[model samples]
Target: MLLKEYRDYFKTELLPVYDEKEIDSFFYITLEAFHQMKRVDLVLKPDFELDGMQLLQWETVLHQLKEEKPIQYIFEETEFFGLPFYVNENVLIPRPETEELVEWIINSVPEIAGDRKIKILDIGTGSGCIAVSLAKNLPEAEVFAIDVSEKALEVARRNARQNEASVTFWHQDILNTDILSETFDIIVSNPPYVRNLEKQEIAKNVLDFEPHLALFVEDHDPLLFYRKITQLATKNLNRNGLLFFEINQYLGKEMEDLLQEYAFENIELRKDIYENDRMTKAVRKSYS
Candidate 1:
């Protein structure tokens, strides 16, 4: 079957489920993943063809898409912070807002000048996106990441190796731990902040296919992870150390309050590209 014909068929089948732009994105991304063909290649060779097996593969993906499966989970990979990461049902696919959190951390740190090395930790490091990205970009920092799920940690470890970013992975559950083993110069988390009541607002693809363990919190206590991490920060963060979080947009004010209650200084809440309050940063009080 010709690639162009298949593209049209793909679009038609998915038009009811997704918009034109998203369908095009899915099509080109799958084309590149499965056949190593870029959009320009398809345009150049208008008559490009797919063999029987390739057609079968595309058909399988089409069915999955129709069922609202995430393309990243279907492909078992994604790009975050311009770095390749392997993702699966065991971990949540990295989101763009979280990338913004990473950038905030990277920019907040001054360049290391001497033998001084900064230590960083990522709590709930699903897929290790934040930790790996920071390690890749800030080569001088010693990065550590922790996840409760062993399977999630497996994916995170592979991503660290794939990106050639040196990160230490821990399998401890942060909620169960009383204190971090070591103090960090910076700590960051994009932990489960979505309230149960907000599940209806989530897209079908995310609601159905993404790991809920990494995406949700009890509606009664939406800031569970943030509170615990902030408490830990008070004890485990170096003096004047920075803490960052990718927060639920609706709870930005609450997040700031939590940090303030913990006596963290210089708290700042920032919005993502969409102008939704999605991230927060605070400095550990020098006296604490």
Candidate 2:
């Protein structure tokens, strides 16, 4: 079938599940993935045709889209911080808000960048987006990532290889471990912060498809991960070291209070592009 006709058919077929814009983009993305061609390649060669087998596979993708499956999960890959990562149900698809958190870490730790061996730890590094990006950007830093899911670690390790980023992946449930003995110049996490009570606010797509092990906290103890990680940061961060988090928008003040209790100075809470308080950066008092 002709490419234009296929695009129209796919969009029309998926329209009930997705908006026109998303369907069109998914059609283009799926077409390129199947043909092993670029978007520009399709433009230059509109005569490009899909064979019967290719059309069948494309149709399967459309059917999945109609089920409200995320396109990123279907493709098994996504771009995070401009680096390509392989993803699946095992890992959360990296979001733009998390990208902002990564940028915040990179910008806050520029002084450590020129050093040959600044230690960095990424707790709950699902898909290794934050760790990989930090490793790629701060080449001199020795980056290590920890997660409870070994399956997620596999994807993260592959992503590190794909991006030529050097990172040490560890399978440790952060809530249960004290194995991290060395101090780090920067420590970061995008841990589960969505409270159960506010879960109704989440879209069905996310609640249905995304990994809940990485998305939720009990309603009564919403800052569970933050509390756990901050304990580690207080004990393990180097003097003048930085702590960063991608927090729940509803718990910014709560997170800030927790940081202050730990004596983290230079505390600053920042909002995402959406104007919600979505991230925090604080410094442990440095005397070394």
Candidate 3:
């Protein structure tokens, strides 16, 4: 069948489940993934056709999309910070908001002269997105990442290798650890911040498929990971070291207060493109 005909079929099959724009996006993404065909290719080669085997593949993806499965998981791959990553149910799909958080970290890193390497630790690094991205960008930074779930760590490590980013991966439960093994110039986390009550607010695809261990916190104590990471930062961060977090949008003020209570200085809260309070940075106070 002609590619355009199949594209229409794809849209019709998913229109009940997704909007027009989203269906178009899924079509283009799958087109590139399956046939190396871009949207422009379709327009340029209006007579292009898909073989029987390729048609079956498209149908399978269509079925998954009807079930509201995320396309990233369907392909087991995604792009993060302009680098390719392997992903699955074990790790949360890296979001654009998290990219903004990463950009903030990359932009905030002070250039040190000579060979002085900036040390960075990413706690609960799900897909190692932040750590890998920083390693790829900064080049001189020694990047380390920790995740409690060994399965998630597997994915994270694979991503680091695939991206050719030099990052050390550690499997440890941050909440159970008393102190980090080494001091860092910057420490960042995009740990579990979604409360159980907020599950209703999450999209069905995420609620059904994403790893909850990387997404949730107790409603009674929504700041669980933030507080613990902050405690660790106080002990393991070098003087004037930076602490960054991708926080729950609802708890910005509380996050600021938590850092302030710990005497973290230069606290700055910034929003994502959506203008929601999504990320924050604080500097560890110098102890004379």
Candidate 4:
């Protein structure tokens, strides 16, 4: 079939479930992935043909889309910080917000770009997204990552290896124990903070497809993971160390209060691109 014909087919087959915007993006991205091509390729080669087998592959992804499964889950891979990483239902697909958090950490902290070595720990590293990105960017930092799920850790380990980002992966629950035993110059987390009350606000694509273990907390105690990991930072962070978190949008004040309560100094909360109060940074008191 011709490329135009395939585009029309995508618009038709996908229109019932997705609006024009989503349909356009899904059709463009799916077609590109299948063809080892890009949207510009389609624009330049409008007459490109889809062989029978390729059409079948596209149709399969279309069927999965109709079922509301995420396209990223369908592709099983994504790009972050210009590096490729594998993802699955066992781990949450890396999102733009987390990317902003990584940027915030990379920009805010003192990443020794030359010969100096720095220690960085990523608590609750999901797909190893944050850890791998930091490792890729900060060549002089020793990046360590931890996750509670062995399966998730397996995926994270592979991501580290795939990205060639020399991160240490540990399958330990941050809340249960303090196996780290070493101090870090920076400790960061994008832990589960979506309270049960906010679950309904999450889109169906996320609620039904993504792992709940990595996305939620009970409404009664929404800051459970944050509180725990922050406490861990207090014990495990080096003097003059920085702690960072990508918190729930609504909990900025609460998170700030918690950080202040712990005697953390120079607490700062920053908004993400969408102007939501999303990321935080605090420093432990400097020891002479």
Candidate 5:
């Protein structure tokens, strides 16, 4: 079966389930992942054939996509912050908004004291995207990550190793913990912020396939992770330390208020590429 032939199949079948652009993306991504074939290869060798077994696997994945399984999960890997991470049902797929959070941290390194090494911690690290990205990009910093799920931690550890980023992974529930063994210069969390009530807003692809343990909080306490992490940050951050969060767009004002209540100064909220208020940074103050 020629690869070009499948393009028509996708346009006819997948277009009903996914937009034309997404179908095109799936086609190219599947080609690259399975055959190491580039888009140019398809155009240049329009008659190039797919073996029977290859066509079988491609059809299988097409069914999964039609059921709204994410392309990332189907491939079991994704690129985040310009690095690759192994993902599974145990870990949530990293997002572009979270990459913006990481870029914010990387860009803020100049504000940190250059005389000493910066210490960074990522709470509820999931696939360890933030911790590994920071470790890889900010090599001078000491990076650590914690996740409650041992299964998720296994994926995070693999991601750190595969990315060659030195991040220490810990198994601990962020909400139950009160203190770290030592203080950090920067603590960041992109923890479970999606309230149960907001689950309807999530696409079936995510709601069905992603790990709920890493995505949700009680509807009544949408700020559960934020409040707990801020409390821990208060005691666990060094004076003048920084705190950052990839936040729920609907709860940005509540996040700011929570930071202010904790006396974290210079609170700033920033929008993601989609213009949603998606990231926040605050500074811990020193008492003279």
Candidate 6:
């Protein structure tokens, strides 16, 4: 089928389920993924046609889209921090808010002396997006990541290799661990902060298809991971080391309170581009 004809067909088939903007995005993404056709190529040659096998691939992806499966999962890959990452049901898809958390860490590195090597740990490192991005951008950082799910760690390890970032991967669960064997200069996590009660706020695509094990906590104990990680940080981080978290938007005050109770000093809660409270940073206070 001609590209223009297929575009129209996609709009007709998907518009009822998705908005015009999302349909456009899905069409372009599928075109590039399945046919290696760019939007410019489609515009220049509106007669660009899909072969029989290509059309079959499109039909399969379109059916998955109509079922509300995430496009990233369907493609088995996504771009994070300008680096490509392989993703699947085993790992949670990296979000833009977490990218802001990463940028915050990268921007603060200028204050640290360049010659001093730093050790950093990422707890609950789902796809290893945060850890890999940091290792890639801040080559001086000795990055380590831990996750409860070994399957998730597999994807994270692959991402670290694919991005040429040397990150140590661990299969330990943070919730059960007390102190890490080695001290870190920085500790960061984007753990499962989504409460069961807040699942209504998430989209059907996420709620239905995304890995719940990596996205949710009990509604009564929404700060479960935060509290445990904060305690671990106190024991495992160097004096005055930094701790960062990509938090749930609804739990900004609670997160601050949790850090305060743990005596982490200089706590700062920051917003994402959308102006939602999405990130927090705290320091393990130094003492003479």
lDDT of 3 by residue, 7-106 (tens): 8888889998899999999999999999898989999999988899988999999999999999999999999989999999999999999999999898
Best model per TM-score: 5
lDDT of 6: 0.90
Q: Which stretches of candidate 5 lie over 4 Å from their true place?
A: none
Those runs of model 4 whose alpha carbons end farther than 4 Å from true positions after fitting are 43-47, 111-115, 286-288
Return the TM-score for each candidate structure: 0.96, 0.94, 0.96, 0.93, 0.97, 0.97
Which segments of candidate 2 are over 4 A away from where they belong? 38-47, 111-116, 286-288
Model 2 C-alpha lDDT per residue in residues 10-103, reported as the tens digit of each score: 8778777788888768877886788777778878898878889888898888888888888899999899888888999989999999899988
| Alpha-carbon RMSD of each model | 1.5, 2.0, 1.5, 2.2, 1.2, 1.4
lDDT of 6 at 30: 87
lDDT of 1: 0.92
TM-score result, candidate 6:
0.97
For candidate 6, write residues 6-80 as lDDT tens digits. Answer: 889988998879999999998889878876778897888877788898888988988999999999999999999
At residue 218, candidate 4 shows an lDDT of 92
- How many Å off is the CA of 147 in candidate 1? 0.6
Q: 158-264, model 4: which lDDT tens digit per residue? A: 99889888999888877788546788989999999999888779988899999999999999999999889878777888877889999999999999999988889
Number of the top candidate by lDDT?
A: 3
- The alpha-carbon lDDT assigned to residue 16 of candidate 3 equals 89
Q: What pairs collide in candidate 4?
A: none
Model 3 steric clash pairs = none
Clashes of each: 0, 1, 0, 0, 0, 0
Q: Positional deviation of 236 in candidate 4, in angstroms?
A: 0.8
Q: Write the per-residue lDDT of candidate 5 for residues 1-288, one digit (tens) a residue.
A: 788988799768887788889998999999998889999988888888989999998999999999999999999989998898999999999999999899999999789858889999999999999999999998889999999999999999999999999999999987778778879999999988898889889999999999888899898999999999899888899998999999999999999999999889999999999999999999999632
Question: Any runs in candidate 6 off by more than 4 Å, and if so which?
Answer: none
lDDT of 1 by residue, 1-288 (tens): 899999999999999999999999999999998978898999899988999999999999999999999999999989998998999999999989888889889898883224688999999998999999999999989999999999999999999999999999999988888998899989999999889999889999899888899999999999999999998999999887999999999998999989988899899999999999999999986655
Residue pairs that clash (backbone atoms under 3 angstroms), model 2: 240-286
